[model samples]
Target: MSQREQAILVVSASTDVIDLIFDLCEQCQEASLRLLVVRNTDEVESVLEHHEISLAIVDCSTFTDVEYLNQLAAHLSPMSTMALLEEGTAEGMVAVLRNGADDVFSLAELHLHPQLFIGSLQRQLQRVRMIEEVRFLRESLERSLDELKADQHAAQQLQEKLLPPPVRELNHIDFEYVLQPSLLLSGDFVDSIAINEYQTIFYLADVSGHGASSALVTVLLKNMTYRLVRNYNRNSSFDIQSPLATLHRVNRELLLTGLGKHLTMFIGLIDERDSSLTYAVGGHHPMPVLAQGGEVAFLEGRGMPIGLFEKPVFDERRIALDPTYSITLFSDGILEVAEGDSLDEKEQVLLAACGGKNLSPQSICDFIIPAGRVNPDDVAIMTVSRV
Candidate 1:
């Protein structure tokens, strides 16, 4: 396995030719060559079974079938270099070299000056060492990549566990959501939690960018929401019910983390007693669609994206919820998948999708994303309905 100890193979029919190769190898002790002497083709095959021959020296004059020797050399290690030793004329030597030999050595001249053969073997050993080093580095890189993929898969599983249930019902109101990531990790996130007996808070946020970095922000947002709920329960003065106040708290927390990421979000608080929906928008596009009494229209709200500025103001809008109404919220990724040439045309397609009878998150996803098609961005859908 060491670079200095190279495996060398010498094939010949005459015992004297094999001894000459072994003697030359011994003269070059600095090369540290391990010689494997094989007389016949069967012996060559046997030697190959036990050892990885790095350099093959074939005695062309002793072996009449140069083609067979060429085939045997080809079957050896890909890094193996071959040299032909011919005692005949230059024309015969050229013919043997053309068959497959990397270099040709005059057997008669080698007997007079063995140093010429020793120098050529040393060069072949250097080439073998370089090939082995490259092979080692390639294998190491492949192992590192495999380990990285395993870690990513584990992180994805943890993220999925943190997501809210696909379908949750609170106080006769049904909250349904679907989250699809372009990659293993998603930037879009959704959550619905009942603040009190009569109030339920739900939000869908699309963080700027995709993959692990954006996914990290979702975890921070979820933790912030939990902390906000605890604060509301402990202190009556803390206004977690207000959509604008909730956005403000989230914006401050996101900035404090210094992640340099912003998000477009639609946060809403539904009061079951009053039958009203109070919501705030943070630069979210293709607003939530409200469907009731055969009419469909986008909810009204607009503001800067969260985590962008220190004192950014968010607008809070309150609307009376119809007895039989469905409000569906979507991340901007829906527009990219929608069939349209422009934003306005895409908005129409979305409105048409939500215009008809009440559709669940699964149905909406099926309509927008065709079967056997992949999404280019992270998509999140949340539908809260009171029937």
Candidate 2:
């Protein structure tokens, strides 16, 4: 696993060939260059254990058979290789090169053009070093990619864990929710927190983007709402429990953080004693559907998205709920799934799906939303019903 020192490997017993390599190394002034000397194929593996052999110089006079030279060349590669033969066998260069030697040289050429021969060796060595460097960089990049994936996976698990159960109880009300993500990290989130024995505050928020940046905002939203609940429990603030005040608190915090993320959300407070739902809307589209009195209609409320402006104002809306009622809330991703040519057409389809009497959250979503879509936008669907 350890990276080895780069070197040239010369496989020969002849003192002339060995001396030629030493002379070339000195003539090139490669003071740090290391040479690995081996006499036979048996010694090749042992030398490889210590040095990263970049170039192999094989004296092919004893390996004239094409098949044997081919085998030798195969063993020396992917390191650059050169074949040396006796001067009279000039025709051997073609066979050696075709068999995969990067270059071929002769003892006669080295003697006649010493400078040119050294130049050729230098070029081959430079090429081999470049190949090794590229391989090392590729491995390092792969390791970095793996680490990023691991971190994203951990963040996704924690995000899923923070969600409420599919079926949650708060006095006379019940809550249900489902989430689908476009990627390893999602921008959509939903949760419920009990403000008191009789009041449960629930909301679904869709942050501006997908992946880690938006995911961090979802975590902030959860923490902000919890801090508000703690304030209510300590009797430090009552407005903290109101859906309108909660949106205002979140908007202020988001602006202060300067994270450049904003979200559209619908927060509701279910008062069991009054059989009423008090809620606030932060520019959430396809507003929460109210299914009561054997009919379905979109709740009427509008406001600026949170985290966008400094003096932003939102309104608190109230609607009386029947003894048996269901309120379905969806992030705008529903429109992406709803069949339509335009936003108006998609809204109509969403309304039609909710016409049934007393449909559960899962039933409403299952009817309107298709599953197994590739690269779907982040979606959070939630329903609060009296049971």
Candidate 3:
């Protein structure tokens, strides 16, 4: 049965009036009616607490004041109400409607014909059920969205744990980095690990896209890097320091599964003994300028990105590290910043940030990043310096 046709509630202030409604409710054939005689405002709250009242047939003859009627309307639920009125002015009828009554019934007409009252009450109850159903659905959707948001937050935290945190005081090298994700799970990833006592390796990679899918690929890359590093330690032929060979292996593995996947990456290994830095690029953005004494020089890569073409030649670039120079490896998101007058303008701003007399990696990043571009895509920046 419809919720409207299940049960009803009858409210009246006077004992005689209550008895009259109880008798009429018994006579009605449509649905069952539950009667509650509310002597005053004190009983309204108590009655509502225990009983699931659907429709209220309020006694309007005794509860005639606007304030009392308004109190009942305010305490009751919205969208389902039936007002009882005496044969009076049109203003009284309008007042009942303005107070949120679905329909106002005349007491005289109700006594003259019982069928009309039953039919009108039944119609109002049907409307009440419809509104209740909509309200139920809306609440359910809100709860589901809240749960999804909470799950996403948990996933983001787990993804962060997978990322390698910055290592402080790595022998003779001074480094700093920043990672800002556009979404809860970012596609950009960075890591720094020591290959041996004399060589420390670092790589910055941007997956093909953003969000959870790209984040999963980044986790896979990290695991692969870990496995390869271990292999290099155990065997002499792995060439752990060769960035090009690493990219080639990663590219082949990603393409084998036909995942339509690819990555832009820059991998670097620092030889602490001679301060020589060997690096390779995989279709990543051009390297940042190596800034020294207010001058800038290009550090361009000579290879295509990984996972695009098979047997792609990976070119490794090397530079002798200078205590006076800073080597920056960054994602395209920084260069793609939209607020600048031009790409040159953005580059100039970044160069100026690094131009500070006592600049650190964190300080330089903080200066160059505009407020508006803080997050729109994954932005990762890493700088390596010879201390």
Candidate with the greatest lDDT versus the true structure? 1
Residue pair clashes in candidate 1? none
Best-matching candidate per TM-score? 2
Model 2 lDDT tens row, 126-205:
77767787888889988998999999999999888877887888876888887878889989999988888878889999
**C-alpha RMSD by candidate, in order:** 3.2, 2.6, 4.0
lDDT of each residue in 1-387, candidate 3, tens digit only:
234433455566667666766666676654544556676656777887887666777766666576667767666776456777767468888987787676777777668876777777768666767777887788998999899889879878888888766644466666677888888888888888788888888888988878777887788888878888999888954756788888987898888867776888888888878878888888877466576645666576767888889878777888777656666777877776534688777766776666656566556666767665556678887876653
Off by over 4 Å in 1: 1-5, 12-40, 43-47, 60-64, 88-99, 109-127, 236-239, 370-372
| Candidate number that wins on lDDT, 1 or 2 | 1
Cα-based lDDT for every prediction: 0.84, 0.82, 0.73
lDDT agreement of model 2 with the native: 0.82
TM-score of 1: 0.86
376 in model 3: Cα distance from truth in Å? 2.0
> What digit string (tens of lDDT, one per residue) describes model 1 on residues 1-387?
455567888877878878887788788745467878877777887898899777888876656677885686578656554555655577867776667676677778778877877787777677778887888788988999899789779878878888888998987789999998999899999998888898989999999998888989999888888778888898853567888998998998899988999998999999989899999999898799999877899998799999999999788999998888999999999888888889998888888878767699889888877687778888888899987
For model 2 the local lDDT of residue 24 reads 74
* Candidate with the larger TM-score of 1 and 2: 2
Sort by lDDT, top down from the best? 1, 2, 3
